[model samples]
Target: MAFLAQFRAAPNLLTMVRLFTIPFIVIEILDGNFGVAFALFILAGISDGFDGLLARWLDQKTTLGLYLDPIADKLLLSTLFLVLTHVGIIPRYVTVLVFSRDFGILLIATLLFATHTLRDFRPSLFGKLNTLVQIVALLTILGEKAFSSHQFTTLNATLVRSIAFLAPLSAAQYAWIVIQRLHSAEDPPRRSAPKTGLAQISAVEGADPSGSTDRVAS
Candidate 1:
């Protein structure tokens, strides 16, 4: 019980640790140490999954965890994309599309927060699917290097193309949802004034300051 309690209290800390591993992974990959880089990547991915599950199972969910998890995932994936692209393993266009979507989302999120219109914008099915595709693409590309087969190369290329197309489509759907929610919140129904006894009394007083007999008195 004590062990579980400690884990629950520090889920976000685990996430931060995962983010820190990203730079090391990039450096290793750049140094032509794919073995260590690949291992670090897998460890990061496993920690990502573990943190979320641990938080839920231990009943230790926090707002910080909610934000940190996605940021960590983005940081790791975005860094890998750039590093892999730099090494000429993955296509540059796919990285561009992935980064563009992430940047656009961040910009929109900032705008919404600045306007005090931010809401609980949970990940949609499409967004989740896009992330899954990205992971598959990255892993497939890395696997191609590790295994070095014609089949892996062909599969990696196919995954790369799929991610390039799907990432933007998912991003557009997210943007549309944001716009719709914003518009709906900004255009609420006009409120009607209440008709109270005090209002009637005020009207009568204005009409006849002498307190002359009004319809109610009659």
Candidate 2:
């Protein structure tokens, strides 16, 4: 009963809906139903926007929701990137950059958690920017495919370049953040609390850093 209660919250239920929508969206893509996939993707995005707002409004934020929200977002975005690449809608290299950055961050976060090195996993600004870039890129590609629009051609090309640039840049930023936090942790005693003022605000503004949520987009 205790565990079951976690899913009872409105925000979490909405997140679960998004997770369940992913497979259908993938199937639509595989079946060459780009229009349907596009519609479903938009719907999923709507749910994502609402879940967080609902969490705050209803005071329903849970550890499970924090982790589940981003996992769903990543799963949806990453899977779409791969499938789009397979279908020839997106370039393989763009997907590669996306995967590489995400994998590297996940690897580092895992090590830190396992070793008990750091606890506050906040998303750096770069990570948030990367996530935005990736989202826009995906949406542009999907819209182009669904609508068969040549206008999106130039925009798609631009976003591709942005993704290529932002992926490694964000990864590097995350690396620096980790190093800073580690050093702060090792600080003699009083100089701890690595993030302060603007730094702390930026970290908390985005997804949860610990990769348990989107902020860590790390």
Best by lDDT: 2
Tens digits of per-residue lDDT, candidate 1, 68-179, equal 7888898888989998999988889989999999899889888888877885777867899989988988776665565554677777777888889888998999999888
* lDDT (10s digit) by residue, model 2, range 25-99: 999999999899999999999999999999999998898897999899999989998998898877899899999
Please report the candidate that would top TM-score against the real structure.
Answer: 2
Report every candidate's CA lDDT.
0.81, 0.88
CA deviation > 4 Å runs, candidate 2: 190-218
Worst 10 residues of 1 by lDDT: 209-218
Number of clashes found in candidate 2 = 5
- RMSD of candidates 1 onward, in order: 8.9, 13.9
TM-scores for all predictions: 0.79, 0.84
CA displacement after TM-score superposition, residue 81 of candidate 2 (Å): 0.6
